[model samples]
Every structure is written in structure tokens, then in C-alpha cells.
Target: MRTQVRVVSRWIGDEQGVTSIEYALLAAMFSVAVLGSVVTLKGSLGDAYEAVATAVTLAVTTAMALVS
Candidate 1:
């Protein structure tokens, strides 16, 4: 029918929803980037904590040896 054809054409040409769709895509991309950064930093942070812990243990043992 002509009415249905016109409706479909109008829907296809409509720009009202474009901004919303673009924003949704932008948000999705930002979330992915943040998640990736967090995952990468997780490993680095663990390594740093381990290094600090080892340093503290060494310092404590040295102090104890000097005291004794």
C-alpha cells in the first residue's frame, strides 16, 4: 500500500534517532577502553605490590639481624 511505503520511507530518512544511536556507540567504545585499561593495570599493580612487600621483608630482616 502507498501509506505503508511512505511510512517506511519516512522511517528510513528520519534523523531524530541518529544522535541517540551515536551516543550509545560512543558510550560502548568508552566502556571497552576503560575495561581494557583496568585489566592491563591490574597486572602491573600486582607486580608493584609484590615488589614493595619483598622490599619490606628484606628491610625487616636486616633490622632484626642488626639488633641481634
Candidate 2:
């Protein structure tokens, strides 16, 4: 019974495993934040690209008309 108690106490005192777990949790949280940002910005980025494409198409059409 004393040996079992000692082992448990020693395990509880050891912090290496705890530190690793904390780092893993931190990384997971950072990954979640990055993924959320990307998802939220996806629609905005798509809309901006579409707007730029439309403007370029219009400019090209206007230039071609002037040339003709």
C-alpha cells in the first residue's frame, strides 16, 4: 500500500506529460482560430475577385470598342 501511494505521488509530481499536453492543446486552439478565419474570409475574398474580374472585362471591352 505504501509503494502504491509513493508511485501515485511521484506520478502526480511529474510535470513533463502535463507540459506536453498543454502545448498540444495550445496548437489545437491556434489551428482552430486559423481555420475559422479562413472560412469567414472565404466569401469576402471570392466577391472581391469577382468584382476585379468584372472590371477588367469591362475595360477590355471598352478598349476594343474604341479601337474598332
Candidate 3:
């Protein structure tokens, strides 16, 4: 019974494994947040580019019609 108590106490004091698990969880959460933001920004930039392209095309067409 004494040996069992000593073993349990030693295991409780050991903390290397717990610290590594906590670091891994924090890194995973940070990576997920960064990836989500990149996806949202990419979609917004694509829409803005398309809108600018359409506006330029319309202006060119109108100017050509007036000149002809």
C-alpha cells in the first residue's frame, strides 16, 4: 500500500505531458482562426475586383456609342 501511494504521488507531480498537450491545443486554435480570416478576405477581394471590371466595361461601351 505504501508503494502504491508513492507511485500515485510521483505521477501526479509529473507535468511534461500536460504542458505539451496544452501547447498543441493552443496552436491548433490559432491556425483555425487564421485560416478562417484568409477565406473571408479572399472572397471579399474577388467580389470587389469583379465589380471594378464590370464598371470599366460599361464606361468604355458608352463612350464608343457616343463617338460613333
Candidate 4:
């Protein structure tokens, strides 16, 4: 009976699964951060491109008017 109790106690004290669970949680957090940044940066880059496109169009129209 004592040996059985010791075996059960040892089993309860083992921590092999804890590290794996912690690493999994950390990976999930990193994935979320990376995904969120890519989405936000994509939006910002699109806005910047639109602004540059508008400026270029205006400049070209003005140049054509001056030439005419």
C-alpha cells in the first residue's frame, strides 16, 4: 500500500506537461501579435499609396495645363 501511495505521489508531482502547455500559450500569443501587426501595416501602407497616387495625378494635370 505504501509503495502504491508513493507511486501516486510521484505521478502527481511530475511536471512534463506543464512546459509544453506554457510554450503552446506563448506561441499563440506571438501568432496573434504578428497577425495583428501585418493587418494594421497593410492598411497604413494602402492609405500612403493612395495619397501618393493623388499627388502624382495633380502634378501631371498641372504640367499639361502649363504646356498647353
Model 3 spans with C-alpha error above 4 angstroms: 45-68
Taking the tens digit of each residue's C-alpha lDDT, what string does model 4 give over 1-68? 99999999999998888888999999999999999998989989899999999999999999999999
lDDT of each: 0.97, 0.99, 0.97, 0.96
Off-target runs (Cα >4 Å) in candidate 2 are 1-6, 50-68
Task: Tell how far residue 19 is off in model 4, in angstroms.
Answer: 0.9
Global lDDT for candidate 3?
0.97
Error of 4 at 41 (Å): 1.0
Model 1 over residues 17-64: C-alpha lDDT tens digits? Answer: 998999999999999999999998998999999999999999999999
lDDT (10s digit) by residue, model 2, range 1-68 = 99999999999999999999999999999999999999999999999999999999999999999999
lDDT of 3 at 11: 97
Candidate closer to the true structure by TM-score (higher is better), 2 or 4: 2
Worst-scoring 10-residue span by lDDT in model 2? 10-19
Residues 5-28, candidate 3, lDDT per residue (tens digit)? 999999999999999999999999
